[model samples]
Target: MRMPTRILLGCDFSSAPTKRKNIVVAVGARQAEDAVRLSALHRFSSLDDWSAWLAAQSAWVGGFDLPFGLPRELVETLHWPGQWAALMAHYGQLERSEIRRQFSGFCASRPAGGKFAHRATDGPAGSSPSMKWVNPPVAWMLHAGVPRLLAIGAHFPAHQPIPERTPPRIALEAYPGLLARQLIGRTSYKSDEAGRQTIERRQAREQMLTALLEGRTELGLKLDIDTAQANALVEDGSGDALDAVLCLVQAAWALRHQDTPGPGYGLPPDIDPVEGWILCAKRP
Candidate 1:
């Protein structure tokens, strides 16, 4: 059994995951000289299955495409538990409908454009607000993700105020969009809409794969994938697969900095645990 020295996982999360809208994961292993191999791709039909896989991996450091925290302003306004631990516990007890209702009410009380309170990390990561319950529904992703990490006793770097520890497994918030923009600058490479999956998107994936393999991005790591795997990655125009790879790259980037001060995987100095920063996201 080859226990990987470093595991890079890119998670394309879905709050209401089904067979069609399954959680997409790209798993990679770090080799010598910061080279990574796309070892596997996984899909989860439900959250229980995903949680089990996470629990079984007792030795890995990875990145997940889910917000780790909610906005401080929203927490305060709703009078939910203020601290991270208490807040997560409180949140874990709520069903989806309640979450939608609470989040919708919060938006209703505010003016348009300012309906959702922003996390400091949202600007840099280009992520949907953690409080948003519709559209991308990132709020639900946080709801589904954070508690599982806590249950599995995984370490969350920059996910909270508690000092980061090098545990059996470590997890960090990741946003593939950040890495994609860095590579393809304003070029659209993926789409869920079948009609929107064009040759241009495939070409963009080709460029992205080339950049990753050549060590051109901020990850400072090279990817080792054969021609067949490369074809699979490029052909999946849903972008879920590529997004997972981007997140994996981000994980690799953060792991290199895990031993530094705060051991936060290159997370910024001013990160708020209640509104955590995305690993390697560029601040505006």
Candidate 2:
């Protein structure tokens, strides 16, 4: 029998226990005539707990909604260590408020045009503004998530502080919204806030789910869910099931390019921990 491909998706992450609420969905893969069969989801509460689960799995792909790197100019201006490890260390030493203050001060000192030093490709990708505190805080996510990925031995690009001895693991930066947008352009499928959920929004989410399964979206990929099952996942309100399905789609996308010569995934050599990769899977 062919071994199953395990896939994980992490959402709403934080560095401390008070901010411990997040969702992790583990997916298992199977082969079918028309599409890939993905198993049910496994949820987790903490990154450390998720790390323990990751150690036990074999081949897998993950979609993490976290930034992989900080802007190099910010690092240079702040006089923090240039290397990834040293930068992470400096970040770890400061409290959240201290870090925010330092970043805000850095922004204040720069000229208006260069107020937020960005990665080279940020403009093309329509990613979050580098200096924004919320709605995709790339800097904070890098500070919070990358160290854990490295500690687990995942292989990311040079800009991350990964240990030399970590496993042959491949880390990809993923944004669930990328796929969600393709399904339903700028529609809100879910919200953690109670007041934001509405019947029309739920119907739109269901349509998005239908589009994913029918391969009607521009993702250039197909999902294996039937209508009934897809509706159930969308109606769950938490978006965990839909998120897991999205991870499965990401895993599928990775599998097609897993055999590329270098990093195995199409990850850039200087993958900013502030950006995400769609990891490639290697054949066993």
Candidate 3:
């Protein structure tokens, strides 16, 4: 079976997608070996629509800004299944309220400050705990996102890779901040609130755009977008569009460097399946 050459996607996901805060998807591909082509920036106004679209699509590798698993410590303490697939299936069957109640009880027993347990990947990826239900609400995102990936029959390279599937629709747990931080270094680039979208933030976005277009990062591949397109990406003060693009860059990097094997597409070799590592996350 002939695989689809260079197909990639970057998704800036939301747990509860609304019209005011949509999920942004950047569809892209490689062109001329060194150029990354961003074909579209699609905004899904609702989770239902996003899930439907994800299920209907195939033949691309995507970097999703969502946690793939919970901390093993938390799961074991709670006496859930130790296996990855069994745990996910068990987790997928519960209602949101049930999950919240269970996680909340776990936190209540622990001390203040660091109440929740974290996955090994959290430190390097700079990601919130998969069990964190508020603020970023990553728990809800896992509740919404993972089941859909399973339903779509997408291949999570970290979790499972079926060799027989042609033109594989591979999914990797991706965090855009991992790459964006490399360029901007603690600078804020986006705000969901229009009033909070300051000039400095806009400049940060511009800096990121320029960096990607010029191949300034470790990724080595430059964008194939026109000047106008590049400007448009920076103009979105919310940063969702740029985030999707950043994830696309990560996927593109993984695609270009096929030899960086292991489930993580450059992640550590002994990555925990129950606590999956993010793509490009280096071992501590």
Candidate 4:
């Protein structure tokens, strides 16, 4: 029997609807060569618009760069109902500014250095708090991204809302760093911001691709790159090639558990199933 082609998606997410810092969705399919081949790249104006698109996923394996839940500590401290449904209900009642104020107050009450106590998995996963406003502000991404996934009844770890008559939607919380670190060992990649670009960084990217194709990383996924693709991943400053690779890792993970408990595509063992994963550097 022929295997069904897996539709794969990678997202560079932002919570707010703005001209800058908007969310980018990269769609592709896993080729017989075991590489993720591009289909389309979309930029959405708002979470609602993005959700509308996600509602169409019947054959997709998605990797989103957003945290799925608030820290248990944060949720409990705020006294805003612990269950996912109740918490979302309460959160939905408040405005964005109000939510920011509450979180800011919580930080103010804590010691300077210990202001934010994150989950054990957060550091390794390279994710920002769903509430953090600065430096990879992922809180907004969750607010913007999760609800859409929920509305579409996408299968995620913490928020499992079932959409009636919808096709099976498989979405994963992905961390791009998981695969990047495996190949590059915590080095920087192409930055969209112009101020951070450098020649040495460009060289590092090439070395990273070579290492990935040579299977030198700890990840079990082997890269199949020809001369042109390798150059695209390494020399092109867009980072599109690497992002697609991240989607491939997510696809591999999803395929492994497509028929098992929680559909085998749930968060990793170390991750709190409630908190979910932001699928970064994954091993196939």
lDDT of 4 by residue, 1-284 (tens): 44345577877666775655456676766545344455566777777777777776656678777777777788889887777766765766677788889889889999988777475467766655666856766666666677777667676643554334324567777776667766777778787666665777788788877675565754344555467656656664656446656655566555545544432554454445445555532322
Query: Ten residues in a row with the worst lDDT in model 3?
Result: 159-168
All candidates in order of TM-score, best leading: 3, 1, 4, 2
TM-score versus the correct structure, for each prediction: 0.92, 0.77, 0.93, 0.79
Q: Model 3 over residues 22-88: C-alpha lDDT tens digits?
A: 8999998887677789988889998889878876775778889998888999999899988877888
Candidate 1 Cα outliers beyond 4 Å, as residue runs:
1-6, 161-165
What is the lDDT ranking, best to worst? Answer: 3, 1, 4, 2
Q: After superposition, how far is residue 280 of candidate 2 from its true place, in Å?
A: 11
Evaluate all candidate structures by whole-model CA lDDT and list the values in order: 0.82, 0.60, 0.84, 0.64
The alpha-carbon deviation from the true structure for residue 172 of candidate 2, after best TM-score superposition, in angstroms, is 1.0
Q: What is the TM-score (0 to 1) of candidate 1?
A: 0.92
Better of 1 and 3 by lDDT: 3
The best candidate in terms of lDDT: 3
What's the TM for model 3? 0.93
CA shift of 19, model 1, Å: 2.2
**TM-score of candidate 2 against the unseen true structure:** 0.77
Question: Lowest-lDDT window of 10 residues in candidate 2?
Answer: 275-284
